[model samples]
Target: MTYTRVCPLAEIPQDGALAVEIDDTPVALVRSGEGVFALSDICSHAEVSLSEGEVYDGTIECWLHGSCFDLASGKPTNPPATQPVATYKVKVEDGDVYVSLGSDE
Candidate 1:
């Protein structure tokens, strides 16, 4: 699979996320526990961007509804959100963040 360069690793702070559009898809780049993750930027329960939410315990909580989603699986761990988001594959290369439209898990 081709790993496309997205952003610099320093752009995303620890326990923070950034929204990026690739191929017209908004992907959420999350930095949790010294790791980088990519997921669907839209909240499953709302049209809001997950990047606006806060990150804690490896999950991103929707700022609109307070719903939390797993960074690794994109699964909802809280109410008000039952639908699962799509998580992309992410890799860090020499301080740069690379993501794949394929798989990270």
Candidate 2:
């Protein structure tokens, strides 16, 4: 998977998320606790933006349905969401956030 620059690392809060549009697809970049993750912006339970949700405890809770997803794998950790969102590989270089849009992690 080829990595593409998403945004500056500082743009994402220590425990929050940011969304970037790549190839017409919205991708959510989350900084949950100590780890950074990349996942699809849409929530699995409903048509809501995951980037607008809250992130904590290594998970991102969808604001629409209140489903918590593992930031690392984009897998649902709670109810209201049985399907998992797609995840992508992310890497940090210097102070920039890079993502591989074609590959799911």
Candidate 3:
């Protein structure tokens, strides 16, 4: 899979998220204590931007309905989201963040 550079690693705040678009795919770049993760920016339950929400403990909370999704697997850890969002592969190289849209990891 081809990985496209999204943004600088410094752009994403620690324990927070940032929204980016690669080839028209909206991706939420999340930084947790473990590492950086990439997921679909839209929340599965509300079709809202997940990057606008809060990130804690490797989970991103949906701002609209309080749904929390796990960054690693894109699984919803809390309601009102039942379905999981899409997750992409993420890599950091030379202080830059890259995301692969070819597969839903």
TM-score of each: 0.95, 0.94, 0.96
lDDT of each residue in 15-88, candidate 2, tens digit only: 99998888888999998766789999999899699999989888899998899999888899999999999998
CA RMSD (A), model 2: 1.6
Q: Which stretches of candidate 1 lie over 4 Å from their true place?
A: 103-105
Cα misplacement distance, residue 56 of candidate 2 (Å): 0.8
lDDT for model 1: 0.92
Predicted structure with the largest lDDT when compared to the true one: 3
Candidate 3 residues 32-80, lDDT tens each? 9969999999999999999999999889999999999999999999888
- Winner on lDDT between 1 and 3 is 3
The digit string of per-residue lDDT tens for model 1 on 1-105 reads: 888899899998789999999888899999999779999999999979999999999899999989999999999999999999998888898999999987534
What do the candidate models score in CA lDDT, each in turn? Answer: 0.92, 0.89, 0.94
Model 2: runs farther than 4 Å from truth?
none
Top-TM-score structure, candidate number: 3
Q: Which stretch of 10 consecutive residues in model 1 shows the poorest summed lDDT? A: 96-105
